[model samples]
Target: MIIEPRIQNPASLLPDAVKAINLLYKAAHSAGVPDSTLELVHLRASQINGCSACVDAGARGARKAGETEERLYAVAVWRETPYFTEAERAALALAEAATRLADRADAVSDDVWAEAARHFDEKELAAIVLWVATTNFFNRINAATRQPAPQTWG
Candidate 1:
């Protein structure tokens, strides 16, 4: 494999940044969102961002969470697929909308927000939003740094 990482791991080089991100992660998880749903959101956002490392890591996390391969593979085309529930579809739509803010004049439209709200309560919705944002943040960083997918997450 090619050496793709442009620099040392930011978590090691900048402990404060890592701590902040870790705190955000902890807060995101405390919102009571399901692990599978969170992983799906992360994977979908990473896919949209074209971040291979995040995609790889998200896929592994989904698998560990008992997500089927068929469902995971269909996440990119979830709208046309029958693999996801209405709730999952809403979350995916929200993730796409939030991640592709420049795709339209009004990103995260009312309809999308309403759909997500219907499926998740306020706290859950907050967690999902934070999860999407955090995933996108990592996606941008990994893409910019040319970080390669790790062989294993351990």
Candidate 2:
């Protein structure tokens, strides 16, 4: 495990993180992804990254948006569950591909892209990509910083 010791000074990387987050937030809002799907993608990415804070926040967001506990728990094993729609499946695939970047040595494959394309237009696709990227950034920061989650991310 990489144990980053607490430093007296904030890392020089903080500003860059904020910039990327701001850009992604703008893109996500402009892309018009439904709030539910956004929360789902965030949760899925957090799960993949093993970021507990993100998981907690995303789960609360899902619950506040009326998602069932069963479905929330099942998200980690989504393929084995029947709670998701085709669109949701596609988005999940995108999230997985984005999070496990090393595994997809060939990069985003035609099949995955096609699946996402079927469910999302260009603008929506942009949103989906931004969502995956942004969530990954947040996961890394929160995991590395050992930040605790707030009671609500709604």
* lDDT of model number 1: 0.92
* Reference-based lDDT, residue 63, model 1: 99
Model 2: weakest 10-residue lDDT segment is 3-12
Top TM-score hit: 1
Off by over 4 Å in 2: 1-23, 150-154
Worst 10 residues of 1 by lDDT: 1-10
Best by the lDDT measure: 1
Residue-wise C-alpha lDDT for candidate 1, range 1-154, written one tens digit per residue: 6656899767678889998999989988898888899999999999999999899999999999999999999999999989998998999999999999999999999999999999999999999999999999999888887888876637
Clashes of each: 0, 0
lDDT at position 55, candidate 2: 95
Q: What lDDT is reached at residue 148 by model 2? A: 55
TM-score of 2: 0.82
CA lDDT of every candidate:
0.92, 0.82
